[model samples]
Target chain A: MKHITDFTIVRREQLGQHYFALTLRHPGTLPSIAAGQFVEVEVMGTREVMLRRPISIHDVNPAENTLTLLIQVVGKGTRQLATLQEGDTLNLIYPLGHGFSVEGRNPLLVGGGAGIAPLLYLAKCYKAKGVETTILLGGRTKELIPVREAFEPYGKLLISTEDGSLGEKGMVTQHSLFSAAYDHICTCGPTPMMKAVGRYAVEKGVDCEVSLENMMACGIGACLCCVTDTDEGHKCVCKEGPVFDALKLKKWMGIE
Target chain B: MAKLETKIHNITLKNPVMTASGTFGYGEEFADFIDLTRLGGIIVKGTTGERRQGNAYPRMAETPSGMLNAVGLQNVGVENFCKQVYPRIKVIDTNILVNVSGSSIEEYCSVAEQINELPNIPGIELNISCPNVKKGGMGFGTNPEMAAQVVSEVRKVYGKTLIVKLTPNVTSIVDIAKAVEQAGADSVSLINTMLGMAIDVERQRPYLSTITGGLSGPCVKPVAVRMVWQVAHAVQIPVVGLGGISCANDALEFLMAGAKAIEVGTANFVDPTVTVKIVEGLQDYCQRHKIDDINDIIGII
Candidate 1:
């Protein structure tokens, strides 16, 4: 079911120069939200960006009736959304799209750039289940990196920056962690980076799932935009996934 | 409640508010969000004789007060709609019309014939205006002779209400509407998305993978109203107006411009409950105006 609710921005924390975290508080009972799922936040302040921005669920605190979103300045919509101040009412379609799967498999979470928002929640869920987890965070530079304070307690956090500014210097795939073994790998980032990660997993004979960030209007399956061609067929990234098994996807270095 | 009944060809709808094609994917997807029974009708996605994978990703982009889409008729074949989709939507307890598309006359007639056999499906809206497909979509819609040919051929086998959806990407939309009406279309729906393209200035690339996609939203509403008004005057058949309709006021604009009914298109993405909301709003409008019937407001301007 779709929940259209009004929320007030209670806290806004600028993580770095480009990234910020928004904490929105609602009055009613919170809808069931899972890791890897996202919410379609309506850009109410402007009519130019009429369609809602699909932001991944960064975190949710039930007792406080609050939801968190970690957003990076990407375009007009994200920039406009970032301007929302504390106490501003916002409308959102909550808990949309299918989330991640952790059944019968250990997970190594990988996130790069704006795709890193959903990983914090996934790490929390895995930590609660006593599943040993590790996260490989990638970005272009240390200044562009998302804040790691929330994700630190959940798992092992490893960071890589292309400019050699922080953590291990280089793209995520060049990090030393890829040499390790794993039962499953879940990643979300730019298509190229995820494809690299997917290719690595496929080569290592590991189960892999990648969350796609396709342009979308309706967060629901109504709009066929956000469709990603996979082995099964053309599937809506907003519905069947923002998350899919790497093998089910085509075009990841000849998986097609 | 004021009488919200509306008629398209021989079939009477519960109201004048229906969900537009391609926007309202088979009724089940919105079941949790909107009560399907409250809608006047539902026009599901475009169905062809063969399954189409549609276009490449970045199929859509947000423009000024609107969005552009190039989802090139991604649908399961007509047979799949019968075996899989029909069973799910048949029980929705509302009018369900199949939006049919094709690459050739034979494909159009064959797909319409298959839908004609389905007891639950009351009609097939011939989608000759789709702009995303490289061939056959706008190719047929832009020419009056070709539009007539496709309509006449589909009319032969599809023994049900035939509503031909017309394209706005043409020199004269009324000419095509007249041609389809002359070719025996039961009704005509105006103003499919206008062909448009947007560029990502930072990337120096087309925003949509198709490069050119159909533009829909509040930005196109005035053009839709103008074409709908023109087509309504030119053709004797009922006109189902749609373009950038988002709310009841927008729907009313189409109705006042001479549309017998209105279809909420891109608005479904904004609010899933918009159609039902428009229905209730229509009722409210009628009550406020002291009009007993919704039909009294159509073409009233």
Candidate 2:
């Protein structure tokens, strides 16, 4: 069940130049969070910031009831979140939105830039299910690539940077897996990158899902703020899914 | 116990606190965050006569103290609302008022008649003040004739309480308030999100997808209080005031401004439990002042 509970910041770290991860330890057993699911984090610096920030769950420590959030400091809310340290109890609505499905034998997870956060947990889930896992993580430069070591143990790791600053010097779609055989595939990145991956999957007839990052308020279906057009019509990204089948989206099919 | 009871015509809400329409989606969504029955009332989302696809994406944009939305009444229409939403909300033990909106007076009456069939729903707030839609939304509320026409027409078939929610964009809101009252409206609620817009200078475009949207939050509180006070004085019906009310203290201002009750709107986005908190705050304020009746504070200023 989803809950609004107090989570103390167990630790905090800067994954790279652009991303910071805040690990929150819940007071009780942590709810089981699937990949692609997110949490609404209440930033506590000031009363002026009226809404809670919706962030994807970066990683989870179930036994200790702690969860990590990957926040990119692009605005005031994230900058306030980056200011917090260990021991401060922050409130959170845990395990929100729909998560990824791990039903395939061979699964390839692709992530671009900061969108790699949720994919790590997704890689771990697929690994636990005994599926062969491979992750192709991308960034603009080597310095922007987030925590690489955390993902190394979960799957076969691949990297791409635009400046040849890291591994292969190009987008994640440039990886051989872009055309490689896989039973299922998942991608989360900039919309154009996701759309590109969607086009490839459609051509290859591979099952693919993409997590959308629409601006949200209420972090629930009630507000109707974060809606996306799909084959079934408009759906609240906060509820029906932040993770959606690539084929169901109108944009993925090159229609919208 | 303090008398927080509020009666408009024959219907009496347990308290003068209602989750405003649009902000509170069908009352069922906030169920997990707070208890539904504890609220004074729940004004579900705007429902029209037919299922509405609403406006295009990029509907809501946030501001410093408030937010702007161009959702344009995206709902399943009244028929689907009755079938899909009504059963779930009907179980909640509180006043559930459907905010009725439409492109025409016939549309308003058609939706109201549907709500009239639902047994648990106590009333319908004729939403003539929605500024987000392009058609008969705030257009009706801005004009006294259109406002009265919808109210008078809905009042004919709908036997329950008919509350007219007026827009703040009008030249003289008191005229619209008086018109609705004369049309047999049981009560009136004020200040449904002031018409406003924001711009993205870097992108050189409008902030909201609709070019403009309804501005709501703490910034609009003073305007809401002023309008509620003026309309309460101009009309004899009970007044329900709302605009950027984030806390109990904010709600007190509206009550003192002669509003019989108050609705918490955009504040719910900030704090889902704010209504219950305001309910508690009102009681605490009454106790501190040694005032046994909550209604005594109305128009105290």
Best by lDDT: 1
What is candidate 1's lDDT per residue for A131-224, written digit by digit as tens? 8678888999988777666678987889999999999999999999865487889899888999999988887888888899988888888889
User: Each candidate's lDDT (Cα)?
Assistant: 0.89, 0.86
What candidate 1 keeps of the native contacts, as a fraction, is: 0.91
Across residues B1-301, which tens digit of lDDT does each residue of candidate 1 receive?
A: 7998999998789998888899989978788777899988899999999899999888999899898999999998899999999988899888999999998888899999999999988988999999999879889999999999999999989889999999999999999999999999999998899999999998999998889999999999999999999988888999999988888889999999999888898988988878888998888888899989888889876
Error of 1 at A26 (Å): 3.0
**Model 2 CAPRI quality:** medium
Scored by DockQ, the top model is 1
- Positional deviation of residue A216's Cα in model 2 after best superposition, in angstroms: 0.8
Report how far off residue A255 is in candidate 2 (Å).
4.1
Residues B1-301 of candidate 2: C-alpha lDDT, one tens digit per residue: 7989988777788888998998889887778788888888999999998887777788888887888888889899899999988987798899999999999988888899989999998898999988888889999998888788888888999999888898899899999999999999999999898888989898999877899899889989999999999998888889999999988899999999998889998878767778999999999999999989988999887
> Residue A39: error of model 1 in Å?
0.7
Clashing pairs in 2: B217-B244
